[model samples]
Target: MTILRRLAAAAIVIGLGMTALGLAATADWRLGLIVNFRLQLLFGFMILVAIMIAVGDRRWLVPAVAGLAINAILVGPWFGFGLGTSSGESVTVLHLNLLAANRDTAAVVELLHETDADIAFLAEATASWRRRLRLVEIPFDVVATPGDVRFGIIALSRIPVETRVLGVSTFQLPTPLLSFDLDGEPITVMSFHTTSPVNTRRDAARDEQLMALSDLVSSVDGHGVLIGDLNATPWTPGMSLIEDAGYQNSLRSSGLQPSWPAGLGPFMIPIDHAFHSEGLEVIDRRTVASSGSDHLGVEIELAVKR
Candidate 1:
């Protein structure tokens, strides 16, 4: 019995230590592996507690309960908050990656109109897809560069776009960086579908594109909004680099919501995001319903503070 008590105490101490380490090492880029390992320790601790409970070890159960309580207090709320709120005079924008396989253009278009976003950015748009989008009239001004496999991006805006440009050879992916003026407010927006990191070649290409995009955003003179299917999560190291470059994540400011692999279970990761500069106030944010696409649409409203 004494030996069991000692083992239980050791487990509790180790679990708490790992949790603390994870929280502390989160800010250091070099300690990413350490942080990840600490997270694993937390999970392992839970598994150990379950085993102890199954074995009917009452002495070990006390420490197990305490460890769980600590984890709940620290890590549980990280997944629960909604995105930020905004003051008046804000424009809402929607970002969606209509997958190449998705054919429900009508439903997507209707949702775009229903959302009443000031601007809507859609990726994986082909020439035919653009024609279908023309049926929706809310976005009077539209810009698109259609590709062979419907892998291009299109921006539809209610406000007149004064300037627009496609990022030339930014990366292996043929995505574009678009800039526009909203009633004298200069907003630079980029819509991209980086190569997924499922393969080495694709992952390298995606990382390069992200680096280039980060450079472009940093060099811009005015407010910027980067909306797209980044194919990377906010918690990842690459995304952290972007965060370091003076832009804030829209979802992280309010909540950490996952938006991916639609039709699957809820244990999803947030790969699609809209990041903005400090000049904008994020009012409201939400994820739209699945439109036969693997990814769900994310909408963010921002007030351009003068």
Candidate 2:
């Protein structure tokens, strides 16, 4: 084989191993981090396969095709092509991780106003951030939990809302549940910020928080939406618990709206998410530009299922 073909074969072998390792994320938290990049892996394999095909390098075709298949299965569901739509009163919701230390209040506020979402959930919203937001003209009623500076949660709404702070989970983060009426229909919105799983302990804590959120969703009597920086991706292990709770990931139809590590562009992952109950369906969803945080905000329009 030529030097170029040899290099292609070596890369394909490594890429196939990485794809297999990502599938083991359910067995190890560190591997879970790798799994979040399944989209990148899939694209990398595709590019490699195309190059090999162009050069007529057939020797490594089998392993290259296998690598592509593995990554494709892990990343395909998010690009939900045949997901049906819904019709009824719709609400525009926005969820952004404010990156606690971000001081670009004007820019973030401007983004909020520009979106003009009916309901907004801001994660990592510190007391100072809330104070700064208050100084400016906030057109919506606001509720916030200022206990934890790193994960303080905020909910802003134009509709009348009944807000309550639920008990902290294993991660010691308080979850805010917002109850409101949408066109005379009662709807619940829960906003939470799970600890980022950078280590084994943190990963376990995040998993516990995810389970708690799932149980809470299951207990809701009617329609509900989950909005926050979950710190876990749709493909992560614990996410299955959320889906089992009967809430469909809004990103399913919207595809992979990578919202974290905002400046990285293609290197980013969709850790921030919005999931709605069976009674609701997504009408529109997209990621907002990085205003002042490491995470890009998500704006989704959901309507009552018809």
User: Which regions of candidate 2 deviate over 4 angstroms?
Assistant: 82-87, 148-150
Worst 10 residues of 1 by lDDT: 30-39
| CA lDDT scores, all candidates in order | 0.68, 0.83
Model 2 pairs whose backbones collide: none
Among these predicted structures, which one has the highest lDDT?
2
Runs with alpha carbons beyond 4 Å of true place in candidate 1: 1-86, 134-139, 146-150, 168-184
Candidate 2's TM-score reads 0.94
lDDT of 1 at 56: 80
Give residue 258's error in model 1 in angstroms.
Answer: 1.3
RMSD of each: 6.1, 1.8
Ten residues in a row with the worst lDDT in model 2?
80-89
